[model samples]
Every structure is written in C-alpha cells, then in structure tokens.
Target: MADREALINQLAASMGAGGYAQTKYEESRYDPDTGTLYCNGQIITRNTIDLAEGFYKNMQAKCDLKTPEGRQMAAIYQVGIEGISRLRRAEK
Candidate 1:
C-alpha cells in the first residue's frame, strides 16, 4: 500500500539523516501490516520495548519532576520511549 511505502521511506530518510548508513537503511525492512521493523537482520523485540519503558520509569523516579531540569530529562526519556513504542506497535 501507498501508506506503507510512505512510512518506510520516511523511516529510512529519518535514519539516514541521523547519520546511519543509507545502505543499512535500504537493507532494513518494515512491515506495516505487522508494524514490525527489522534492521541489520535483527527484529525489534518486546524485550527491547520493555527495556525502554523501564528505563523511562527509572529516569522519572530518579528525577525531581517538579524542577525544570528534571522535567526536561523526563521529556527526553519519554520521547525515546514513545519512538520505541511506535516502532514496536505490533508488540502491543
């Protein structure tokens, strides 16, 4: 589907822009139907998702959420968790 192709292209482009090798991105695969993304022949797994979530929670608990700096740190971790969640939607 067009939407799937578009999502794949967008992901590859983002990864390329982030300094990842274009060849590696090209070799990667995205299955929109299953919402699974594979890079370097390794499938993103639920364990990775859980790790991200746990890391975010740990960071949140360690930070004083009331402080601006702490809130910023939490926001950063939240973004990482969100990105992982989006990439691993099939695991949900």
Candidate 2:
C-alpha cells in the first residue's frame, strides 16, 4: 500500500539523482513525484513502476539468468514486479 508506493518513490528519486541506466554510458532519470522517467534529458516514460520493471527485464534479457549474477538480479526483479503488481491491484 502506502509503504510500497513510498519505497518505489524513494527508488525512483535515487535513480534520477544518480542518473542510473541499464546500458553503459547512457544517462537516465526518474521523478517519482511526477511519475516520469527521463533519459538523456528526454521524457521516456511516465510510469515509474513499468519503467523499473522494463529496466530489470532488459537487464535480465541481456545477461544469462542461469548464472549466479543473473539469478540474483532476477530474484530482485521478481520482488520489484510483485511490489508493483500489488500496488496496481490495490488501486483496482
């Protein structure tokens, strides 16, 4: 509920302030207040949950999920997805 949304907002703010991105040498940002994601200073998405899920999925796709590193990330991604899903369901 509220806790989940707060956690997601914190994550988004951290990502934006740190300029995090999936790929190398690319800059990306997320503004939780506006639910906006920006990359290279351009608006890419307005849904922070989907943006985070997509980022993790893209990472999972690029790496081998069978490996320890990939598996670790996949597990984290699943938790994130679950959090997002819960929020969505609560909204409905």
Could you tell me every candidate's TM-score relative to the true structure? 0.50, 0.43
True lDDT of residue 85, candidate 2: 64
Q: Please provide, for model 2 over 24-90, each residue's C-alpha lDDT reduced to its tens digit, 9 standing for 90 to 100.
A: 2466544555555456645544465677778867766676677998788878777777755654554
Off by over 4 Å in 1: 1-36, 40-43, 90-92
Cα shift from native, residue 7, model 1 (Å): 31
Measured by TM-score, how close is model 2 to the native structure? 0.43
How many times do residue backbones clash in model 1? 0
In candidate 1, what residue range of length 10 has the lowest lDDT sum?
A: 16-25
| Native-to-model Cα distance after best TM-score fit, residue 38 in candidate 2, in Å | 19
Give the Å shift of residue 73 in candidate 1.
Answer: 0.2
